[model samples]
Target: MLADALGQVPYFSAREVEALVAAWNKPITLRRGEYLVQHGQVERNLYFVKSGLLRIYYPTETEEICVGFAYAPNVVCSFPSFVHGTPSEYCIQALRQSELLGISKNDFAALLELLPNIARFWREELEKVLVGRIDREIDLLLAEPERRLERLLRRSPHIFQLVPKKYIASYLRMTPETLSRLR
Candidate 1:
């Protein structure tokens, strides 16, 4: 899966792809409810999801606000923390049993030196994340729950296959009952 994802990068050559596969050498496993990242923790590794699901959220006194998710064949990381060496406010937790491969900051930095093309992949991924965050902001800004629900349905129908309805409701900034009624 890591090779396949690396292969998709337009700037990567076959050798660069193999180098990435080698760099992502740390194996990780999580049972349900395990935390990949927690508030105040600095995230230093980029993870490739080999299997199962993860929830990206922010914890608060009242609730955990569902913000995003990562699943099999996708990459997962606390972006700001990973990039800036700062502590993350968000938490990434396993929602089900999961397997992953991770590339540490040191390894990735070395790769950035060895393979300039890999930087392109990182930039593109960052761009996508920024765009998605902007779109999610717009979705949350909508006053009507129905509009938010419909927009998500149109934009990410496949998400229903990966995440539970409760998290979907939270992502839409609505109660599960409200989401149920809207559906």
Candidate 2:
């Protein structure tokens, strides 16, 4: 699984990947609706999903807005808090029964200490995620609701099928009624 995930990760050796996996605290299983990380909590761990989906959300004035999702072979966490040792403003929840390999901030730092190459990989991953977020923000600002929904579907078609329409509406910065009209 790690090999498949790292297929495009250059300079990563199989042995190094093994070492990284060995460093994880444990594999945890969560049921649907379970809170992986709660808002205002100090985020100290990163979860690598083995199977299932996780939703990253934040509370708006009156509702929860799902900002993103992580599926199998993806990593999910409130990265800023984990990296800075601060409380998270967002929450992550299991959207389905999930299995994850969890590594605490301390353990991950130790792994990076032992293998600086992994640190480089982590940094690169963060850059890619940030870029994607920026592109999404730009699209949302420039596009109409239907256009935005089309773009989102083009990028992540499965999300439309998996997540509820209400969450999707919030993510698209539209009201549920507007989303219904678009549909």
Candidate 3:
């Protein structure tokens, strides 16, 4: 699974892949709805989802707003917090029972130092994530809620089956009733 995920990262050599495998520990499991990183806590490790799904969200005064999600075979972290060494403003939780492989931030940094290729791969991956965020932000700013939901479904139809309806509704910036009506 780790090798497959590494394949998604461009130009990762076999040795670099081996090094990453060595650095990441065995898979850890989280029960449904369990918090992986809570708001206001420092996220010390970056998780690679081996199975199941995780939601990244922030709590508003009225409710928890879903911001993003990590599906199987994808990396999940509170980016700003992880990069800056600060408490995360968002929480990461298991949307369902999940299996994850994790590498501590320190270990990841050491790996980057040891393998320059991995550093390049990391930069490219972060760039892609940034671009995706910008696109999502534009959608939020310009699209109607129903249009946003339609776009989301077009991009990730599997999300409807994998994630809870309420979270999906929040992620699309619509009420659950609105989501149901659209559906």
Candidate 4:
């Protein structure tokens, strides 16, 4: 699973990949609806999803705002909090029974120092995620609800099948009725 996930990134050497696999061999499991990282807690680890799905969200005055979803073969963490060692403002929860490989922040930092190629790969991956977040922000600001839903479907058509409609509606910044109408 890790090999497949890293196949697209060409920077890692065989040795570096081996080291990464060893370091990330710590396995974790989460049942559906279990919180992996809760708001107000310091996020100490970065998780790689081997299987299943995760939802990232934060509580608002009236409701929880769904910020994103992480599917298998993807990385899921409260990134800002993990990087800065601050309490997370968001929460990460398992949307389905999940299998994950985790590396603590300190261990990840040490691994980066030990393997420059892996560090480069990590940087590029984070950059891509940052760019995607910026693009999504632009979409949310400029697109109509229907347009937003259309774009999401185009990008991740399977999300409707994998995630609940209410969460999808929250992620799209729309009401459940609006999402139903769109469907």
Best by lDDT: 1
Q: How far off is residue 166 in model 1, in Å?
A: 0.5
lDDT tens digits, residues 1-183, model 3?
A: 988788666687789888998999857899998988889998889898999899999988889999999988888888889989899999999988999999999999999998999899888888988888887887798558888987788878888988889999999988999999999
Candidate 4 local distance difference test against the native: 0.87
Candidate 1 structure quality by residue, lDDT tens digits, 1-183: 889877877778999999999889899999999999989999999999999999999899999999989998889999889989999999999999999999999999898888878877777878998898898889989999999998898988999888999999998999999988988
Measured against the true structure, the TM-scores of the candidates, in listed sequence, are: 0.94, 0.87, 0.92, 0.93
List where candidate 3 sits over 4 angstroms from the true fold. Answer: 8-10
Give each model's whole-structure lDDT: 0.91, 0.83, 0.88, 0.87
Which lDDT tens digits does candidate 4 get at residues 1-183?
886677656766678877777788779999999988998999999899999988999988899999999888888899889989999999899989999999888888998898888899888888989888887887699568998888788878888888999999999999999999989
**Candidates sorted by lDDT, descending order?**
1, 3, 4, 2
Worst 10 residues of 2 by lDDT: 1-10
Q: Note the clash tally of each candidate.
A: 0, 0, 0, 0
Question: After superposition on all CA atoms, what RMSD does each candidate show versus the true structure?
Answer: 1.3, 2.2, 1.6, 1.5
- Estimate candidate 2's alpha-carbon lDDT, on a 0 to 1 scale: 0.83
Better of 1 and 3 by TM-score: 1
Q: Pairing residues by index, what is the TM-score of model 2?
A: 0.87
